[model samples]
Target: MKFNWGNQHKPNLFTLLFLYFLIVLIVPLGLFSAYYALAGNTNQERYLMRQAMNMTTGDASTVAQALESYRHKAYQLSTNPLVVEILKADSLEAESSQSRKLYELLFTVMHGDIYLASANLVSNSGKVRVSTHVFPEVDDLRYHGNDWDMASIINQNSQVSPTASLISIQSHRIAENGRQVVASILRRVYDQEGTNLGYLVVDMYADALSPQVNSDHVLTDMLLVDTKSFYATSLVHPERFGSFDRFPALNTLDGNYTPRSLPSDTSIIAISPIRGTGLHLVGSLSSAPFFQSMENWLSAFSTTMIIGVVLALGLSYLFSRSIARPIKNLAKRMREVEQGKLESREVSSAISEFSQLEHSFNVMIKQIISLLDLTREEQAKLSEAERKALESQMNPHFLFNTLNTIKALARLHGEEDIYTITVKLGKLLRSSIDNRESEATLEQSMALIESYLTIQKLRFADKLTTEVYLDPSCKHIKTPKLIIQPLVENAIIHGLEPKVGSWNLSVRVERAGERISITVGDDGVGFPPDRLPDNLDELANSPHVGVYNVYRRLFLKYGRKLHFSLKSKEGEGTWATISFPDEEAIKEEMQ
Candidate 1:
């Protein structure tokens, strides 16, 4: 069970196009939609939380300023000489007169601010001497211990300098309202001799100290929490007082303005600290409005994503079709060519590359058809030539008889060299005129070349020299008949015949790796540098018929597999080399 990739079925262009669109267009759009959904909701939540914090900070600042003003007034009243004298007076009349003066001082300091509930002056012994509200009895003042602790107030005053003041703010229950929450500011009083006398206590409505919500954000709520006593003033629920720790979320925030989610409701809380006061301002808002807007945006985003996917799929189909149709037509034409139809057909396309490919394909088919017709004509000519060659074979016997007669005459005349030269000439002629075989062994081709060169040696007399070296390993390899002899003839006629000095001609054959090479070299007056032909056609038309014939025969037999080249310079020797594959490889190729 071997897996072949060539045989694997491939997905069609349409399915591939759809998948590409789904990945590149639809997936990204879906991811963007999800990101927008999450990010949009988060941004809205942050914006709403920031608004609530800003409102809470403004309201806290205003309330803090009002509380600070009251604190300063309380300090001034405590330092008043008449108020101090009233606390120190021994006689009832003197106390009453000083008390009247203290009341008038309180009136001057309060200036009819409705937030101030009452202002009272109490002695060191825990007795209220004068008050803007009804004066509480000593026992009553003590019983309302949480409202104003006289002992602690006196002790705190005693530790302070006479010229300075100590102020304390606390949440207390008012007697008249039966545990209604109020904030009290108590400042220490001093006498002329710097004696610690009593305290000036100012009670303010806690509602006045609570942060106010602006009209623009009525849904928002602001709360002021006393971190020390755990008391709180809430804008949303003004009645909520006492320990704010009951709500664990607000309690856990400390005093930093960080927003947190509340478990009790769909609201978020942000707390900010008031500077110079141990109070935290908390802002809270519901998440309903932000959620509504996010829902609407998600709906619109989903609709847009759906439309985008549809559009992407449609465009992908059109794009893939534009590319696939031309390719399919080209493939169909190629299949026709595979079936041996070499007729040309036009395939036009708008794309530049496709148009060029179509033109090249048509031109290629025309060239193939032309080449096949030429090949058929050549085969007909070759068959006619073979018939004529068979008819001429009877003439070789007459020539062989004449060469034998010449050999016998030379022997009778006692000229042994002439007889030997005649014998070699006979062998060369026989080899050339024979047409029974188109191919000859390397041994037979070399023997034919040796005989031809022997004839040339006699013609040139003492001026010509020749060398023939053939490797024993390549002696049995088959090659075209008369292939080597023509090249040797060309060297003798064109190279050695015209040379003045001693001419050298060498023929060598050897195996080079997987190839066999036959080389013919000559030192002679070479052809003019500019007179060499560029191709076989030009060479064939020239006077060098032997070289052209050998080249044409090798090309027809082996095509590009035969390596043949001729190189010469004007004054240097010329070299001709013919190389072909080893015997086994050549046999395989021929088969």
Candidate 2:
């Protein structure tokens, strides 16, 4: 057979196979290689920076625990009644004896914690009344006005009852040497009558926090900085104490772990604040080691990817041949089927999946023919059922009775207005019996209400008066049919029928924001408060069927998108309101 080279229906299988191989293998590999080359180094750096932050967070937690323990112990010593009495003594002899007793108490408390350098009870007169160390250094300590500034160090706002104060960390000068760091906790002492006696100070050496804040990694270093931007202690450079100009950005961070890039030596710094002490633990790590590991990983990955590409090319050729052969055979069979040759020989293939495809095509054609016959039969049955349903809904007896009543009214009254009312009554009865559609425009529903009220006005005469107020903008909105009529009927029967005097009924429709509300109110005998149901479920089994029917229909049609309410007072009045969202109508208008 001769091949038609210009035939648009025929495609060259070899060319199609090569294009498939490129899309399945080469394109994806090229995209992945480009992305890896662009983002590999940046992603690795972010991961390493996160690791450094995690290390600093763990170290900071340990230091915060240790400092909190010291604050609790200091609170106990400061509030002791004996210590307060000693600071308030009148005579020198009484003061001397109480001072000895206070010294014994301090020694017993400080015996377990060797890191505590000194504990002192300083009187308001600027005298060291009691202390763990005799002749402790107190001259260099700064005082604010008549009170020591150290008194503010204790956390006075602690949530614990009898609020414990915070421990303040400060650098104190020692004689003949440089300033040494100390964690000072101070609380004011009060007498039994709530009199201010003096202040208590507990000093802990800052060196005690060195081990917890120190990092063992060779490329990493840690430092502890106080809230004043002064170095409390340093594991890397001890001489940098009292100076924080090296890390100027350290003061800006809060209690969370934050990472910052350093210009010096291309290092990354992570800092986390220590709770209760107003200090931060800063960790720094050099980026050189992290970059070296990334380079090594890239070299090994590139070699592996090269081998993978070579293997993929060889396998792609074999796979393309296997897929292309079956597809070519299937296409030829499809062209035969297009020419109306339904009895063609089955197309066989070496591949199990392709063989299954051939079998499925044969079965589908037979099913399509059978379904076409079934579809015609179903259409005939559906049309017949629709006709029967329409016939059953149109009741001839109700229509005949309504027409006969209108004839009697026309003959007996002999009034021209009675003819107009009968015409409206006919329209209302016809609309109610149709039941072809479940929804009508707001205007159509209002017309039905107008016709029904016109007929009722003739029956009740001067005893009944009705008012209707419809917003011009909401006339075109759609609502469930017969919803308003039932509510109006219920209002007439239950609310206004039993009243002795003239009854007034009002129907109002208004649009507010995205919702439309309809209210039906009557100045008649209202419902008793105790007889009304609380919700729709309770209303289902109640005696009020018309109101409950309208509620159930609205709920089923709109779900939670609509609101229905009824309010009444026994001797005053009754009001029924229905509100539904107008979003769908607004959207249609915009379109």
Candidate 3:
């Protein structure tokens, strides 16, 4: 009995092909995808960094002009005739009468200035004479407690050499509306004889200094910060108003920086000084959005590679078994024939050569073929389902690539409008695709809608006016991502675009206690008065895509807690409002 060592087993086929497929397909593709995604992310982040810097400078200049104007206004208040008379009063009765006149004058100064929290005339004795709000409460020490000194901080921070620049805006807690955080603009008031008469303190809502020019939501956590004290005006993040030293990474950032040298983990910051204001317009862009698509692409591609490798292993095993099994059977049959028993042993296969071996073998071949056919049918169905899923995921990729190509062409020809539109389109796609969460912060939803409106505004130019008024307080409340967007889209598309005259579209999110109301309205061609559906569920069959979709999704997500309404008149415009419990509000209640 001799044993053939070489024929013991041929381990080459399955193992070799498995390694070959992985090495040939998976390794190279993985490397290429990783490298491509990394490079793409880097380039994108660099571009954002440059754009942020440029925007930061523009914003700084705009703010500088505004602040300088406000400074002149403050000086005007100090020199006003009524203000002077209040300081040079003949007696207590005279001062009292003058105070009333000055008080009325302060209200006049703040009449149309919505940002003016208060205009206080602080006397030399540190007594507040008159203010836009309650004069008595304005002088209360309880508000500016903790021994906070107005004159000390102002005198120390004021750069009065060239001209008296109102103390660069400071984070002041005044006794207006429960001592709301406002930026203080203090100017020295004087009598005719040059006797100093306290300071004229004009409290502007911190929002005045907060960044609002950024239509591109790339920047967040913006601040107009004092260089000396780091007292920041953070409208979006009010808690960050007092001091920024708590944010180690944020505080230590240089006078300015770009993403080129920034670490991946740190925020890409752009800073520009507001001239003569002693403050810097600092804006931060998180690395998340810039690199999210790349990370997602790599993760998805890796998953696909894994699936392919697994399928390759199954294929390799099938090929190996198909070739090795039948040959083993044939060899055994030849050994039996060598013993003079000529009948061939049965074998099963789909190979052409084995089909003619024996009748039973042919029958077995037919059964195997039928089984293979059934398997292939099932496999086909699975592959189809998988392909559809892939197509759904690949849609954004195709559209995004197309947008990039269009943007390049637009830039080449210097088509500013087209380029801007394409850039915004890309932003919308990236924002939608990058966030996979079913729920998002209200602020996130606002950003997405804002991006959409921006493109539409560009298309309409001056003919269309869009205003987004968001209660800074409700920004963090949770909501469905596409919840409010479709409504806004409907306003511009269905309500405004078809109108005969100038269109005005507004999206307002107002917080009322624990709940919020989201309203999207337009002054354009509206549906007939009777067309406004009382029930959105019944309108599933209707043509109102935006309102219907929003209603359905919100109803499904929030059940009866969410109330969606649609109202319109043919001559007037339409208003779609969705009101629901603020998740944060509910949580607070529970707590």
Q: TM-score for each prediction?
A: 0.52, 0.41, 0.42
Reference-based TM-score, model 1 = 0.52
lDDT of each: 0.71, 0.70, 0.69
Off by over 4 Å in 1: 1-219, 234-264, 270-281, 305-449, 461-463, 467-491, 499-591
Q: In model 3, which runs have C-alpha deviations exceeding 4 angstroms?
A: 1-34, 90-100, 126-128, 136-163, 169-171, 210-217, 252-264, 302-591
Q: Which ten residues in a row have the lowest lDDT in candidate 3?
A: 255-264
lDDT for predicted candidate 1 compared with the true structure? 0.71
Error of 3 at 171 (Å): 4.2
Across 1-591, the per-residue lDDT of candidate 2 in tens digits comes to 344567766657856786678677766767776676788777767876777677777778887887777667677887887776666772234346665666677877777764435666666665545566543445222343445433234223232223345455443334122324445666677777777666676666545565556546643667776655354446455445545656544443433334443323466677777876667777777777777877777777678778777877787778778888888777787777666566535778888999999888877766766777799999999999999977865676667677768768886889657776768877887787766888898899889999988888888988999999889989988887888888888888888998999989998889998899999999889978877677866877777777888888888877898899889998788999999889787687899
In what order do the candidates fall by lDDT, top score first? 1, 2, 3
Supply candidate 1's per-residue lDDT for 436: 81
Per-residue lDDT of model 3, residues 1-591, tens digit only? 355699657765546655665576567766877677668767777877787677767777877776776676777788887777666652234356666676667767666764545677766555445667665343443355555564233444345542364554454554446545446677777777787766676666655555444546556756677767666666456545566675554544654432222433656777777777677777666767657866787788888878887876677667766766666676666565456444534545698675466456545555666777899999999999999988898787788889999999999999998998898788787866775677888888888887888888787789988888889998788777788888887777788878888989888999888778999888878888677666677677877665677777778878888877788878689888889987766787899
State which candidate has the highest lDDT: 1
- The per-candidate count of clashes, in order, stands at 1, 4, 0
Candidate No. with top TM-score = 1
Report the Cα lDDT for residue 374, model 1: 96
